[model samples]
Target chain A: MRRRASLVLLALAVFFAALSPLVRWYAFPRLAKIPPSQYQDMVLEAKNATLLDYTTMKSKKVPEVSIVQTLKGNVAAAGKVRERTGRDVVVWDTLSYVADDKGRMVSRIPERYVFDAHSQEPVHAGGEHVDGDPVRRRGIEYKWPFGTEKRDYEYFDFQTRTSAPIHYKGTRTVHGLETYYFEQTIPWTKVKVPKKLPLGATPETVEQLGLERWYTTKRMFWVEPVTGAPVDGQEIHEEEMRWTDKPGKKPLTAFAGHVRMRPDYQKATVDLVSSQRRLVLTLTTYLPWGSLALGGLLLVGSLTLEARTRTRGRPPGAGGPPVSSAAPGDPARARRPSPAPGGSGGMAPGAVGAFTGAFLKLLPGRRPPDQLTPAARVPSCARWVRPLRDPPAKGAWDSGRATRPAHPGSPPPRTTRDRR
Target chain B: MRALLAAAAGLAAALALVLAVTATGAPPGETSKKPLHTTVPAHP
Candidate 1:
């Protein structure tokens, strides 16, 4: 019965151990989900640009462009799972307003994003269908395993309303925690310039000021593996314009500056990542493996005890027929005696009985010596009677037996049976 | 031995449930109060 219980325990341990990977895949991603009614305010600045006067054809002092943007968003669960996709949809709305250095309103943009609840990838954004596997959503990537290499991801750009390929650049330590590094670079493209330039120039003069090309924009993110949160981010936006006919001329510096996430945000992200990582490590790695090891040991111990019990229960003289005690030339036969109940020329029956009684007492569910019946004690006594029945040869004592006497006062050998 | 193994299995199951429920119900990390910044060099 005890052995059966041990086997059941071992099976349960194996089951739990197998659950580790499932927790990592399903539970870990959910940690990165953005909740409803979340609000964030970010301040951005466009640094020193040449204040150009198109009417006077002269350059004034440089001016700074400052922007304060507020983002308020919410996520809601879909009522039913969509067709062709067994997962429910998650709807997200982010309303943002931007203001300049003088507190004048710049732009108010309302964006909508829809994603599959399971994959956390954008299905729709900005009233347009975005079809592709998403590498990231809301500044967080979904599922990144350790040792991941130069994998390419299709990233959706909210500003451009398009998807672009981003590359993983391996891992880096951020705030003392290892993180996956990913980068996206948008090349220079000829884009129609916005009506308002940072330096207070009109659209026609802006064209003449050489600010027509969208020079380059680079984005980098340091993402925590367990939670997939971006602990730190860097964005570099650059632009230059040229005359409609002049292609090779020195291009004027339209805008040049770098935007970085605030220290407070990074710190918060780091704390979240650390907590999530620790939880994952304990649940998925330590606990499962620990249970398996301990359960395995217990199973082995139970089996070993059962085998010993069977060996000890064997009848005396079962190994071979009884030999004559008077055989003079056969010292082996003379020294050994049949281990049968009431046998003679062997160890004392009382001593053998006491030793077997003590051994069985150590096992779980077995009666102590004082409670066992004489009939029950006979089999145990027969097990050890042979050694005591035969007296040792004269020279046997001289060899080592007398000198290496067993410790009389020592306690019985410890056994796992007591653990039950 | 049986009790210990049972306890371990119970612990793992409980932890998995807690994590799954928390992930589904609880909010993520709060946004920072500070705002992002980009400074144009004065001499640029």
Candidate 2:
């Protein structure tokens, strides 16, 4: 028995020794990609994925969201606004549900509206933020009412190379729905700001001011407890910078709540709450970025995996095929005759063409790799390409730019939301 | 002594397999790090 136990211990050590590096390499990178803690929570809730059992020290105010589908085949949205103070719990009753085409659901439309106080009136000329550039505080203001509609994509476009962490907090039964409590957090450092800044602002001042204005948005999302999809969730915006003289009294933070109903997935109702009153907007359009994002992720992942395969230590079967040489007689012809069907190695025309394309891409003076290599491969993690032994001078280089260039699917800065 | 050594090696092999599986397994709850490029939409 003693011998057996000793063997077990030795095995455990060896097991960990071999496995630790793998974990550190693959698993560790994931930690960096996770979203901030607060955002993770809210994301899980919205995905209806799961819910975490969190201590509701204070319920605060619950903003009511009404989901609805609009005529343009887009998921249009409008919601009320609300904010509250202290531990005071406010009872809010707002009927918000998604509008469906009789009984069907559509989930991918990119514009939404935020309504005024309680009435259907939109606060800004455009219900949503203006589309093109992010607004700099005290910067050039768009026309009246339109100014109220803030364009976020300019400053908040999704990072194609980063991922937020999802945590399963716990489980709960809400209105007969068994939901899993999953949460995530998005750090302020990862936030993308506008390229240009307001007048009189230094780069440092711009970042500092941006952080101050947006940092306190602690978002707690609740997924469908069961399905891990969005059901309902809330956001608590606290001011990063505090005003003196009024200790404990920070500026009013916006509280927004959302929920998706049956029929159409595009339409949603949102609740925006303030200290004074609660407003609910219905038939708001929801821009479905989830599918678009997933597609981008798959493409990026396949590329990373291919890079890893190339860089990883060769497995036994790798490099087994005989190397081929080109013929000196003709530039385009192979020196040796093509391998026969029963030959040791032969690739079909299609497969050969694909391999040739990839191999040619790695050559210098060609376009850089469409997908950038992971941080590890980049030498020294250079601003664009890291310091590495062999930096590809030619090919498409991964600049590792903080924000990626815009894509077609991204919504326009100004959309019908403005007319609303 | 040789039997003991052989037993130890066998045990080590088994434990290594277990550890490999655990390490490769998906993270508990939600994934801590999602693969880069996976997009998460903002909730309404």
Candidate 3:
């Protein structure tokens, strides 16, 4: 029996080990999906969104982000980063779409306009800044082709899968004020290697790595639940995963980053705390790995139980000899005499009846006093017997609290007399 | 008789181990229904 139990346990361990990968394959994908609508509107409001841009070394840890808001067919920016180098480093091109009186895009503008200074100047290539105009010289240029021809995206439909219901973690503050926070398990989309770069490296390698891991986005929204105002919010995407590029690298510990917005929704501050650039990827891999391991364990345990239930007259898990029928005088059957004179109610001569009559008292209902104090006759039996047969009633009483009234001086109370 | 006894003992042992691990390894909350406390940040 002991051998069989050990084998069963070993089999269970193996089954769980084998099922680990399978469980992960099913669970991680589901956990990774989240509703796209939650952030789609805000993302459109914060047009040309860039969480972090590590294009140049000067902005190594710092991020150059932009949030655009288009209104009355005119685009306006709150915090737009323009690299003010002496030369024209980068250019901004405006997209124009022809709209009817009903305010719907009918056709797109053919020629793209580049603004160096004035809107009248039809330049081939655009510059970082427009000359002549003071605001245009200091700021990036914004131009439109002609009347009823300007581009604007009303809403952004981000491609994302729907998953489990998000658990409302209640509200928290980004910079200040209350905001509704929600959390859900989700996995990252598989990141393909950059073909332009050498074999597996690219400028956006870190960002790609972070996107490949499984993580839960902690999203906070500060809205006038009544007025439906987009006041402030934050998002912290985190995961735990191992580095595929560097073997033996410790998994990224708590790959967490937070982006907070001002009440006006004009400004947002993103702070990323990462030991390595590929933190999110590392986190994503490990969480699913751990969850899968637990699932595997459960699977293995169930399989082992099923195996034991297979009764073929042979031991369930043991490779040893098949168990045979026991002989007539097995120790188990010999433990109790056939047709016991006590008839199950009485105790053996020298044996204490504490187990026989008094055992039932331990249960929750009524029990007789005689049965409760069964050891009362031990001293009388010892006196009647030849050798020091029965243990002294006093010693037995002292040993167990159940023996108190079983002694000679402390006689067992009469139940009939108490009833009268 | 011996086979039956051994099977009973094995089942008991397995049950005890499962109970021990479950009781010790459960998460931070008990089964009783208790109101959750939420911290609402003040308006800034």
lDDT of each: 0.48, 0.28, 0.29
Ranking, DockQ, top scorer first = 1, 2, 3
- B-chain TM-score of model 1: 0.49
Which residue runs does candidate 1 get wrong by more than 4 Å?
A: A4-8, A21-73, A77-85, A95-109, A124-150, A191-215, A240-254, A280-298, A301-420, B1-44
Model 2 sits at an interface RMSD, in angstroms, of 16.2
Give the TM-score, chain B only, in order for the candidates. 0.49, 0.55, 0.55
Q: Is candidate 1 or candidate 2 better by DockQ?
A: 1
For model 3, report DockQ. Answer: 0.03
> Which regions of candidate 2 are displaced past 4 Å?
A1-162, A187-212, A225-228, A239-420, B1-44
Cα lDDT tens digits, model 3, A182-210, are 44334453322222222234426745564
Computed on C-alpha atoms, the DockQ of candidate 1 is 0.10
Compute each candidate's TM-score over C-alphas: 0.53, 0.20, 0.21
- Report the candidate with higher lDDT, 2 versus 3: 3
Candidate 1, residue A31: the lDDT equals 42
* Model 3 bad stretches (over 4 Å): A1-60, A63-162, A169-215, A227-230, A239-242, A245-247, A250-256, A263-420, B1-44
